[model samples]
Target: MSRKEKTWWWVAGIAILVYCLFPIAWIVSVSFKPPADLNSGGFLPDNATFDNYRTILTGNAKDLFRPALRNSFGICLIATAISCLLSMFAAYAIARLDFPGKKLILSTALVVAIFPVISIVTPLFNVWRQIGLYDTWLGLIIPYLSLTLPISIWTMSAFFREIPWEMEQAAQVDGATTWQAFRKVIVPLAAPGVFTTAIIAFFIAWNDFVYGISLTSTDAARPVPAALGLFSGASQFEDPTGAIAAAAVIVTIPVVVLVLLFQRRIVAGLTNGAVKG
Candidate 1:
């Protein structure tokens, strides 16, 4: 490309990055803004402070925010773990085995993944309440598997497919049972893809709002996203925007840290799985 073209590309990329990051920056700014300056209508707070953070951490909103934060972490992690384990096995079967209805299984997972969450929430709501699962982490985790499993299976299956058959055959020749081969050799090789899928699954479960709100009635199972919506002002007449912003920033930090820590593995997994072997 010409110099001008390269420059334009750089400019365009930077612009898009800024555009995507602007909202996060705005929220961070709002989180630091004093309540008195929240409506001052500037990008940066005139008197930036950690008062909003303090509110959620130790002030009036602590009770609601802290429990919800714990719930989010617990539920998302459990859902991600279950989804990754199941999908890893399922995807391995799909990629390594030639079985009847394999296509059907994949198609069904895709369909479930794309199916609207709202349509099923009402039914889930009724069932959970009836089964005494309402307002519980398990209740949310179960539905979350529906959201995270399809993509996990598809993504992990691709990684499995990219792995050479010789590796498994070699293990078997050395007296490894099929299960042993899979556990000791195949699983370790697929670590990048597994990590990638786990992160994606965690993000999906963490971001879930419909199920969190519909199935859970109290702090017992409420996640950060749902609780953020129901946040009340420090006082009845005041706005909860600052506190909410602070909580949002706190919620986002973990996701940022995760991506930063795993970006290399994620990229390698994605690129390796992009094409079938």
Candidate 2:
């Protein structure tokens, strides 16, 4: 490419980056803006303070951030853990073990993944309510399993396929049983892929807004996304734009931190699995 072309490419790339990041930057920036200048129609505020954050952190209100944060974290953590354990073993089985209907099983996984979970939310909600699981973390966790399991199976299956059979054969030669070989050999080898899938599952459960909003009304079970919607209620605060932005920033920090912490493993797992055999 010519110098002009290279310059244009760099400019285009920076513009795209800025466009993507601008909304996120604005959320964080407005979180620090004084309520007086909250929606002052400017990117930067005249006076900035941590009052919005303090309100979210220490303010005494029916729907506060701490409990919502705790609830979201707990639900996401439990859902991710359950999904990861089941997916890891399921992926191993699907990739390595021979079965009468392996192809049928994989095809079913694909079909289930393509279906939207929203369609069944009402029925699930009704069932949970009937069984007294509604508005509870267990209720949320059950639905989340359906959300993450298919993707985890597919992604982890790809990683498992990349493992050479010779590794398992060697373990078997050393008197390791089938389960032992998988536990000691295959699992450690697929650690990066396992972590990557867990992160994906956690984020999916965390960002789920539809189920969180529809299934729970009380603050005790509602997550940050659901609770954030309360700021714009017709009967509540006149204009809570700043408070909403502040809450958004607070909710986003945990996800950003998780991504940064596991970025290396995630990238490596994806690359290794995606590369041609």
Candidate 3:
């Protein structure tokens, strides 16, 4: 490539990076700013303080933030686990076995994944209320499955298709039972895909706002994203923007850590899954 082309590409990459990271940087800046400086019209706070963190961690807002964090962790973890497990089996079958209506099944999953979530929220709200699952952990988990399961099935199925069937057959020929062969031979090879799917599923469940807001009315089952809307300041007249910013930063930490730690696996899983199928 010409030097001009290389320079333009570098400039474009830097611009995109800044565009993406600016919001996160702003949020982190706001989190550290004192309440007085929150609206000071500065990118960086002049009198940054840990007070916002302190307040949300153990001050007045603790009652709201802590429990919501716990609920988010529990609900997202459970939903991700269930989604990955069910998707693994379903995807394995779809990838390996020649079954009737296979293309139809894949198409259905694609349709569900692309469907507008808002259209079904009303129906789900009424149904959950009737069945007494409203405002419960199970209530959130069930609806989350609908969101996470389809993409997970598609991702895992693509990954499964890349695995060699001969490995499982070799294990079986060695007198290993079907279950043993699957557990020992198939699972380890699929670990990266499973882990990637779990991360994606967890993110979907964690970040969902429409369901989180519409389904739960209280802290009992409301995740962090929904609960953020209900956060109050020290007094009724005060804005909770700083505290909210701090809480947002806190919630974002886990996602950043997950991505940093498993970035290579995530990239491999996504690229391979996209290409192989």
The lDDT per prediction is 0.93, 0.86, 0.92
Clashing pairs in 3: none
Which candidate should be chosen as best, given TM-score against the real structure? Answer: 1
Segments in model 1 whose C-alpha atoms lie over 4 Å from true places:
275-277
- Native-referenced Cα lDDT, model 3: 0.92
Q: Can you give the TM-score per candidate against the true fold?
A: 0.97, 0.93, 0.94
- Looking at model 2, which ten-residue stretch has the lowest summed lDDT? 231-240
Q: Please give the range of 10 consecutive residues that has the lowest summed lDDT in model 1.
A: 268-277
Give the per-residue lDDT of model 1 (tens digit) for 120-141. 9998889988999999988888
lDDT of 2 by residue, 140-186 (tens): 89888888888999989999999999999999999999989999999
Query: Which pairs of residues collide in model 1?
Result: none
Model 2, position 250: C-alpha lDDT score: 79
Give the worst 10-residue stretch by lDDT in candidate 3.
Answer: 268-277
lDDT of 3 by residue, 8-38 (tens): 9999999999999999999999998987887
User: RMSD in Å for candidate 2, one decimal?
Assistant: 2.0
Per-residue error (Å), model 3, residue 228 = 0.4
